[model samples]
Target chain A: MPAYVVGHKIPDSDSICSAIALSYLKNAIGEECVPARLGELSPETLFILDKFGFEQPELKLSYAGESLYIVDHSDRVQGPDDIDDATILGIIDHHKLGDITTSTPLECWIRPVGCTNTIIKMMYDFHGVEIPANIAGAMMCAILSDTVIFKSPTCTTADIKCVEALAEIAGIEDPQALGMEMFKVKSAVEGTPIRDLVLRDFKDFDMSGNKVGIGQLEVIDLAIFDEMKDDLHADLAALKEEGGRHSVMLLLTDIMKEGSEILVVSDDDDLTAKAYGKATTEGRVWIDGIMSRKKQVVPPLQDSFAG
Target chain B: MPAYVVGHKIPDSDSICSAIALSYLKNAIGEECVPARLGELSPETLFILDKFGFEQPELKLSYAGESLYIVDHSDRVQGPDDIDDATILGIIDHHKLGDITTSTPLECWIRPVGCTNTIIKMMYDFHGVEIPANIAGAMMCAILSDTVIFKSPTCTTADIKCVEALAEIAGIEDPQALGMEMFKVKSAVEGTPIRDLVLRDFKDFDMSGNKVGIGQLEVIDLAIFDEMKDDLHADLAALKEEGGRHSVMLLLTDIMKEGSEILVVSDDDDLTAKAYGKATTEGRVWIDGIMSRKKQVVPPLQDSFAG
Candidate 1:
């Protein structure tokens, strides 16, 4: 069987685009790989795929007995349920090293970059493989999405340079304008179900055996979520109880304003206060300059949970 | 202080040379780094360093409050005692992914190659840094030592290509002859202390919280250790007791014979049978084509322990 190139659960643009682009590169280098996703794509991801003239990857939930090349994640919590039973052929990620152990040796290309696609682009260059224009477009948009259009603190020079190169290959003249267009699609919250909004960019973490779920919604303005905080909090509470999670958080991130309004629902009342040193008022708190969840939020929460 | 690049305890040629060569590459890229050894180097490593006109790295036991770039290892058990207190700047390894998690994003270049020096060589090329002849010579010797002169099962095409490139840089006409010369030095077992032999390439593993120590001696012949097996077993027993380890194993690997005679001194009597599916006589068992402790021995033992 051909190896499956898969991404994390609750697939983001970087996760989806990385799987596709990396699978293309691997096939170009004579490796039989099929792109797969663990969950449904969000509006932003859908927009990027449609704009790039690409089809959504096949959905594959369980990975038992399959050869997998995981993309965009290294954490077990973010992987398929039976990942332990699967043979992980390789891992391409851009996050902190997570608790995943393989019995045999495997290929790994993990870096402290802004996006996995940036590392994928470097791999393409290393192998001297030319990326297709549509795939390059998808990869460029993935970088823009992950780095918050170069406004996020996690954005590095490598990410910017990759986006520039990918944009040239993709024939995109105004990448920033395209980024705004993608975020505009992501900002469409009206008439959307509360669960859909919360689950759009959700991820569950296993912090010291305490399951914590976090979701983010990036938009040009925070006022779109101002009137919906109560419903979002109710939905988060239901999600926390349904998943038996210790806490469920939703970050209403205003990309232009460069901050986030966090709505937290937890079994413990002081969860936010302990993790961020900022007390929550009715399970809500506003933090300045908090943009990246993988960088800014998850680390502190993981440390707090460990302590 | 510059970031210290160190390898696993009981340093071998690959461990020592990878640290030195990677530190040199980092320095060429304007990153200040110092090569360090976690423990005493083996005779093989010492020979390679001396032949390449390089000094031995400084020994450092504790890593508390220091910035570290780990080479050839990712497991916490094989790292410094206070590694949890230190900041791990990056990891460059060729082993299975061990249980090590970082809170922040870090650079990682792990591959299923035969040697860490091969991966470091790729890093040098990736950074467009020219490796010095001395470092190239040391790296080539390290690869030869780890891959058993291209006879190991862990050896890959990448490793062979890297050796060819490094041999050109280091002016090595016959790489296999140099490999044989290094093995002759490694095969010198006469007049060596029992403790020094056992501790030469030893490594401690935390298997389900049960500390298991394993060591390997790769030589051109196994007959050299026939008369010394009893003393080695006694020393392993004492070492196990002193360190409170559940087991201590030594692989007398015959590189030329392409096999190993395993001397296991474990708390349990059936460890060899359970781990390798082979019956042992007086804590000794022979297995054909078992030259790599990391590949052939450790994985099965780890799985058996986990079970």
Candidate 2:
């Protein structure tokens, strides 16, 4: 069987594009590689595929009995269903590694970059493989999405350089124009069910014995949050009860402000106070100058939960 | 309690210097950090420490009470004895990660470099911390020792840059002359017992539950092997049998040629053949361009063992 390249479940634009681009580059270098996805593609990801004129890769639940190359995420919880049994040939990622151990040594290209597509771009440069325009366009969109158009703290100089180079290859004259277009598709969830909206960009983490879920939404203003605050609280409370999660936090992030107004519903009230170092105002708190969840949110929460 | 930084169980010149240098840098930045060791010091390490007018750090079987920042390694077999109980704050190393997992996320700096000191040098440069002469001299010597004075296949352009910068700070006009001086003290193994000499730079490994020990001796000539072949074989056989090891391999590495003539004493005859993909000629085989045990030796053998 050919090697399948995939990203984590709950596929974002970055996960989808990186899998497509990395598998393409690997196949270009005479390797048997195919892009695969673990879950249903988001609407923004579909928009990127359509814009780039590329077909969507096959969806997969488990890749057992096949050689695999994982991208975008490293945590076993966030990976495919068969990640525990699959023969992981390599990993290309940009996150804190989870509990994954290989029987033998494999190439692990994990960096503290804003996106895995940046690392994949570095790989293509090192191997002298020229990425096609479609792949380049897809990767460029992912970078813009993940880094919040270079406004995120995770956006490093390496990522900035890659974005400039990829944009030129993809014939994108104005990144802001493209970014706004993608965000328009990204935030077109006004009519989505409250539970689905909360889980659109959600991830679960295990802190000690607590199961915690965090969901984020990008919006033009906080008025949408005001409009649906009660329903969101009810959904989060019900979801927490159903999943046995100790806490649930939602980030109603404003794209222009570069901050997250957090709304937390938890079984333990002191958990939020300990995690953010302050008490919330009626289940809402403000975190100014916070963009990326991995760098800003996860570390502090894990530290508090450990304590 | 302050954090303690240490290397692997068999502390080499590079491991010792890196631990000391990193601790000092961390302490300078206002973190309570101390240098530590897990094993007895090698003669070459002692020579460098004495030459730099620095004292050896405290030897520890395990730092169970304090959080750790491991410098040179992360494998459980090579970590502190109480690694399972001790909380790890971070890891900075240059090796393939073994079966080690953290409860919460922690900072990990793993790079494909020649030496851990090289990574620490980049750290100091990035942080803009000035290195004192003694620390600079110690780190410089470690870079030279680990890279075999830039002759080993593991040496990269980054290692070369670190050597040049450190040589200037350490006030060494000629690195090669100093390298020879260090190596003379480094290769003084004639008077030691055969067992001690063979285990001078040794590491134990666990590959799919198979126990292995590989030791390397960097020498100016193979005449030493001709002199001690019989005694070395007797000791390795006794050690393997007593320790219940699957196999033990010794590499008599020639510094000038960048090659290692391997000698195997195994309970399983096909183990070496399967690992190396070639039959040994009467208990010996020469690998012409092998340098790094972590990169070159461990991966292929682990793959063969897993298969």
Candidate 3:
């Protein structure tokens, strides 16, 4: 079977770009691999795809009977719908896993690094393939997006070093200027509907049996969310019911302020208070010095679901 | 968590010695790991351990909180009972896998090589650790056991080269004579009970969840099984009931003849006939030139179950 290199649901910049970069690396090593995505691309992901002159990967919902090389994430809930039926040829990820069992043995490299592309960079070196300039651009843009220009708590020294080397290969002398251009597209929200904005970077989680949804939007300012707070909360409520979610959370992050204004819609308010440990004034609270949803946000939500 | 390196149930010489060799290599590389077994040792395995002057690894049924580095097998039915609870740090196997899901990313290297010890040797060279004489002897013995001294169908060119290199390191002038000496203990069964002989190298298979048991005995002659056929059949019935097995097959292999006289105790007789495509007389059939049960026997049984 031909290998489909794919990322998890909610196609963030890192997931989409890393899938492309890894698929390129594997193809260079004589593997028949197709890069694919799991969900619709966010604006930041689209910006990277456009800059790298690549089309968005085909959105695949199920991959039964296919040979899969999963990247970016290995969580079962975020995998293709018929994941168990697929033959997992390999897995390369940097996240806490969900229970994904394969019928046969395969290659798996799960590390504690920041971005999946960092692992891909190491593979390119190992295989002695020089990263093409466009693929290097994709990797560099992904590291910047997932680590929030090294501001997110998940960023590691490996990420910092790899991004610099990739920048040199891609002929980008000023990575910070390119990052600002990418974030400018990320912060724009004039013509986009509020519901579309809320769903742009949405991710779902399964804690025990309870289904939870977390949506985050990074902007230079929080007043965009403040103006549409009521509409976004209403949309989140509808999304929770429509998606059969037990709770819904929105992390409106201000990159310049380096903080988040988290909005919650949970059946238990006390559980939310216990999770975040701050007063719920109008169902929102400020979290200082927090940017990583993977590190800071998901753990508390998982604990609250357990409680 | 400290790593617990384990082999499959029914600890054959290859499984036991490979686990010990892998644990040694990991310890040499600064990993805190303990070698473990899943069941009682076969006489052949005991012979190898005593020859190597090594104690038996701890028999472990379950390892809940420890990190696991599974070797020799990846079948969950043959792994620790609480396999899902343990953190899977790595996997090194040379078999078709069972459904084992880990909660985190890990290092997995599964190949179609002849033995797990072959893979361990590759890892030793990759890590620049020189295999000592005794340790190389253990790996050489395991390769001999698994490949049936290069006569089994599963034996590859890699296994032949690896065994020769290991023999040089192990200071064995004539490895063939050493293997014959080892086979002496394997064929000796004057005082061994009928049940103990049957259980000596028995292994179970899970074919789409149906439990199938295959027992093998390699003797210099088959006159022993011919005299004890009725008692062996009765004991197999008891073992099938006790183990909740769907079928039980005993392959009375003769080393001199290089073939097996198979005894069948299946719910479907036609399936067995179709699986082997051989005529049977009173539940016994002589198949010529069959040595490797994994390569030549189990595939047809799995297909019969599929039908």
Lowest-sum lDDT 10-residue window in model 3 chain B? B96-105
Cα deviation at A203, candidate 3, in Å, is 4.6
Off by over 4 Å in 3: A58-65, A83-86, A122-130, A143-190, A194-224, A247-307, B13-18, B25-29, B47-53, B125-130, B147-190, B194-224, B249-307
Give me the candidate number with maximum lDDT: 1
Model 2, C-alpha of A123: deviation from truth (Å): 13
Tens digits of per-residue lDDT for model 2, B107-211: 566566778898889778756899998899999899888888888767789888998899899998998888888887867778899989778888888877988
Model 2, A1-307: lDDT tens per residue?
Answer: 6899998878888888988998888888998899988877777889999999988889888877788888887677788777656778777877766666665435567677888899899779757899888889899999999888888888889888998899999898987689888887887877788887888788888776788888888765667677898889888888899889989988888888879888888877876678777778888888888677787788788778877
- Residues B6-91 of candidate 3: C-alpha lDDT, one tens digit per residue: 88887888778878888888899999888999899876778778877889999988888778788887777778888866778777
DockQ of each: 0.82, 0.16, 0.31
Ranking by lDDT: 1, 2, 3
Flag regions of model 1 displaced more than 4 Å. Answer: none
Q: Which ten residues in a row have the lowest lDDT in candidate 1 chain B?
A: B80-89
lDDT for every model? 0.92, 0.82, 0.81
Error of 2 at B21 (Å): 1.6
